[model samples]
Target: SSLTDKIKLQEEDKSENKKIKSFEELEKETRESSLKTLDDYFKFISELDRNDWFGVFVNAISSRFDPHTNYMAPDDKERFDVSISGKFEGIGARLQKKNDFTEITELISGGPAWRGKELEPGDVILKVAQGDGEPVDISGMRLDNVVKKIKGPKGTEVRLTVKKVDGTIKVISLIRDMVETEETYAKSSVVERNGVKYGIIYLPKFYIDFENKDSRDAGKDVAIEVERLKQQGVSGIIMDVRDNGGGSLKTAVDITGLFIEQGPVVQIKSAGTKKEVLYDRDAKVQWDGPLVVMVNNFSASASEILAAAIQDYKRGIVIGSKQTYGKGTVQNVIDLNQFVRGNTVGDLGALKTTTQKFYRINGGSTQLEGVASDVIMPDRYSHINIGERDLENAMPWSKIDAAPYDTWKKQDNFEKALQNSKSRMALNEHFQLIEKNAKWTKERKDAAVYSLKLDEFKKEQEKIEAESKTFKPITDYQNDLKFKPIPEDEVVMQKDESFKEKRERWFESLSKDIYVEEALNVLDDLQAKPVTKGEINLKKKGVKSK
Candidate 1:
């Protein structure tokens, strides 16, 4: 059977395979199919014009200076702008290429595709047609070309022929509109454990709108979320920036101010210039209770700055991976068209290049050594080389004079909480398995050579699969904590089923997160005990009493 037919049969509802091919036969078939696909891909690439190749060449040259520096074409620049702003005029369905077919990975919430409820994730897009026009087959087409065909001006119709996961085929029509990427914004949820409520704020990026000041930005949105969480009577808050690849620098500083008293947050230095410290001058602390900033290996730039500042001031416990993504340098996207005058060469796109470097208030740069978590957690990527230090042309780590700041002294049990969390991690069965899996993954990565003989390959795969079964419980482990949205979100969820579904999925994931469970435990340990009137009187009299 063809790939499409096989996919239809295998993924159909209540379907089962009638026959199973041997491993060798299946492997041989896959190899031949993949080779033909590769041949087709190269053939398509061979027909590209000079302008397309020029764009690639320009980017290749720009990358030699640094990994972050790049030359974006006109279309690339448009996409970059949409990403930073978190909005775009399109059908709002994210697509990925699977072999020769275009697969819908996600439908932006509240957008046309999602609101229509016709298209869904895992549905294969077979054809696209512009408003009552002839349909064009998208098979074997470049992903970008397919995207171009689907996205159009607002209110315009785009008809897509899709193969549903249940082996059904249908044509869905959607009107393009301004779709907001809700996942890029900050959202909060409340979870209670042991009679105390905790707020979990997930900030995917420090987004900002340069063109419109009134538009929603990360700083404003997160501040609003913090206020909402406070209204829910949360005793502690967890700011989760895990996998956040960073965005606006100003938002990072603004967010840091929410937890701490007015103080220096980060430092910046350009070539041949003295260091300048960015401070959060606002004296109004939003939430003064126990805090935890969660981060992982993918947290970079703005995320690192937030974690580093929190760590420096002892305002919160940094928990998650050993260190972050280590991207301390800043980038500025310069419009290339500004350099040209009265030219007919069309759109020149832009250039994003390294500008300055950022440092923690304590003086150390997060360059090649990202902020170290106070309570390190074991993850599958723990043993992998995935930080700035592993990348070519990455900046080196350095230090400067520490900025003037005061450490948080209100939480006297900070050290105790840190020690308790570390001890818990050391004894956690799930974490132990994660550590073992990480080491095993590293070993497999290192030992890449394998026998080509079918029997030997089958035997090796069987042995590896048997060994991997030991770590299967990691995915099945659940902390069983229930998370609920704030009252405001609950109201919106009542009117929007899609919004409710998205929140439920997030809550389900949080319930299974052991790291979050541990963070809450640390928060529990950090809770201050109520002082008695006698102790207060003794303190007032300047008398030391037990």
Candidate 2:
């Protein structure tokens, strides 16, 4: 029976919507089973109008906004509950449709496909098969059905014929496994320059499983990694928290504990409730070394919390854009069946209502005023500004009593060193490139009208290109789509130096990104000061003469 029909029958039983009988009505409605075949499914789909189809899709995915949230339609929920979980598993890769073809956007890092080493981003999957027979072309197929066909039990093999970007085709086989979330653990690396090493820990996301209470969480994993990095003699560490959407709150505090000796990491303030201060255990310090956190506009939720705490306690330098996504509010998933009881309209889907607001240890809410960067850099989002501050229903920025903690002592000549670095960056080739791109982007964004007339549009585009050609190019001269904004490149190397065209030149130039180069330079300056009486001295710098 359709979900709507079930609700209709229940509503008729009690002429009023607020009054639903007892647990029996709820249990009986929830336990209702569906008996339908593949043909029946398609027949039902074919009968639906455009609006109905869209409504069905919306109803199917509505409850998945939260990590633990889910909405199971009758037909789909049956397969998940009755059957095995591993069958809906394959090489564990996230695929997406771009233009008209299915392309691999991200590899599961350590999954079967990643281990095969054949699949990569931008590779188009042309066909799939079970054995060494003819492959089936799955072009123009729906993404869900395509995934369903590819996924199966563990140890089972599947073959994929993929087409490279250069049009070359090859076949590769991979075994399936029930993908585990823990497999995406914290990864760490070290970068060394001029005898000073800085550990780079890239946390993809904060994750914790609710079912397995004993499993090692992200906080515990990060603590272990930090200890290992300290053992390797790293002078400092860069906690790169980019694109991390956030996970368990418990892990957030645990992760913060690694750096902070003891203090409140974050404060939770809600309506008509006592403020709660979540403190780090004063157990031991993993690495209280000089710290720098790298974040972008996409850095959100728990990412903002970690960055805010470090900033509040003056424990680290926050480096990135002007700010991050201001998502300070915390939400609680209230199962409608629990609170609303019998007064719900069908499965009004669990309400993910916002309950509490998170604040930095210093009492500043991270809502609108996302942790500001100490030093801002040129990013694509530099010019295009839009964040939580520019939202309609966004909460106001406020603060409470500040927490007491020793501020991370400013390194001698820190400001002078940063200014000198910025000066050098302004004169850098890559910085100029980004600046030009930003200006051009702003103009395009502010353009009043677009022309469809071929001649007029081409003429305008050519004019823009001619003006841009005067500036020195960054990296190399490539026929990228961005150049199409103007029309042509003028091959003008009148003032600046131009190098011979070599693939290695592009690779080597990008290998030392201007932003990363500046970051490394800062790290170098920071490493020169000797640890005397737990205080830094710039004059007695341990400079190595070549």
Candidate 3:
């Protein structure tokens, strides 16, 4: 039943003078409701044609090899392409189903919808029309079907009849165009601590356009961001790949090359082939200063590669969760249409199958065992089962002969800096609370059974909620740090209000991030300093005197 239905049922029960449901009666009703839902789902599945069943069967077969191997239908393939490429031809607005209506969540900056300034976030989409075609009332329609009706080839027209936030109905016309998902790209910010500036580059994924060589890729964009930071005279850089689930392998190698001199980034191995080492032949170091890479359990594949390479070379300190997502296998999408000559059967879609496995330059596979952080930090998922190891059919961890690579020796205080971070993490109260919360979360997750009786359930939930209230400070805690956009981003933000809002929100989060504060502290420790306290004080006095 829908939420509204459930609420109406409760109201009806209250209006009618009826005895409260007994535990057995409630349990029987709950079972009947669940069985009804299942029956409806099976009925829908029974109505599916052979093509849909064939796709499901194919996916089931492919998944048997590994969890990552799967089939993509035509529409699914389109979505996959957009995700990796970070661009799509559409109305450029994100939508969510709010009850029976589709609400606009966000308008992609620089896209037609944003440029028009007619459709805004919170506007409920009522009807959709293709060019001058008849409008179709989409009330209670599936969100995906609504999206299909709205998205089209570039240069086409999409007319949306939306109910505005002010309770006014208006028809907005927008020409569908190539919309780039800004969050998918690399972005950077500058922060100052103790009279030294540091750069923070957040790469959500190793995105690339396989069809377009000259397009923006994570590697190129990160290098650009690094150069921008260099121009700002930053003393250190923090590469934040936390929650990044990985993307292109080449982009990972390219991004890693920005920090170190020419070296092997990662090694690849096929089923029956010798290992192939991907080398960064470019000797030009974009940011050779003190470096730190931030990651969490969601960071996988390309993210692991970058972190592992940096760790192996002693290029940077990896901080955050105990380990990354541990996905080492590589996949290649094979277009199934290529096999048929002059095919008439609609698009057969593509198959993403594991082709090879990637290992760190140190020759250790980030499969079941991901890259362990140099300085482990406490997070909510600390005690939870996560990463590739959690998957039943995940690949095994292995090691081969270590690739010949030289460790970076520029920072003499590397060990000292790591120790300082570990000491700080040990003593931090916020982190301690976070660790406690993680244990509590794991305990709650393990205690799956719950009382279904209203009074008993309420009491149980109240007890849990009361305990959780103790950890509220973990979310409320904020560090006294300021993060600002670079001049280039600032200029862009000034022209685009939506972009400005997004950057400001990012800045707000950064200000509250204790992890970022600690990262900067580590960067400070990694700096080459005077031998003695007197000399450091003397240098500071001399600068003040000047």
Candidate closest to the true structure, highest TM-score: 1
Error of 2 at 542 (Å): 26
Which tens-of-lDDT digit does each residue in 1-546 have in candidate 2?
A: 123333544666755456765545654644442222234445645776754565457644653442223343333444443322222467867676544457774565446776566786557786777866545556655455557767888899888877643233566788887665533567565655554666767676777766688886788888877876777788987787765656677788888788878878888888888899888867587776677777776677788999988877666777777798777878775654555656645544344456888888887898877878766776645665545664444677888877666655645545654565566555555555566665665565456574756456556655655655544243343311110000011132222233112212333332434454455455554554743322211212211122
Pitting candidate 1 against candidate 3, the one with the higher lDDT is: 1
lDDT of 2: 0.61
Q: List the residue pairs that clash in candidate 3.
A: none
lDDT at 243, model 2: 52
Q: Each model's C-alpha lDDT? A: 0.81, 0.61, 0.80
- On lDDT, who's better, 1 or 2? 1
Q: Arrange candidates, best lDDT first.
A: 1, 3, 2
Models 1 onward score TM values of 0.78, 0.60, 0.77
Estimate, for each residue in 1-546, the C-alpha lDDT of model 1 and write its tens digit.
233323443455364655655555555765676576567567778987876788879967987788789888888888887756567789877777666789885566557887786886557898788998856667888777889899889999999988764334577999999887776679999998656788999997888887899999999999999999999999999999987878899999999999898999999999889999999999999989999999998788899999999999999999999899999999999999998899699998889999999999999998989999999998876886767887677878999999989999999989988887777776666678788887886676456476866557656755765877777677676776799999999999999997898788788778877778878877777789632323211111111112
Off by over 4 Å in 2: 1-183, 339-348, 390-392, 409-417, 446-448, 457-512, 528-546
Query: In model 1, which regions exceed 4 Å deviation?
Result: 1-32, 87-180, 530-546
RMSD of 2: 18.4
What does the lDDT read for residue 431 in candidate 1? 78
What is the lDDT, from 0 to 100, of the residue 285 in candidate 1? 96
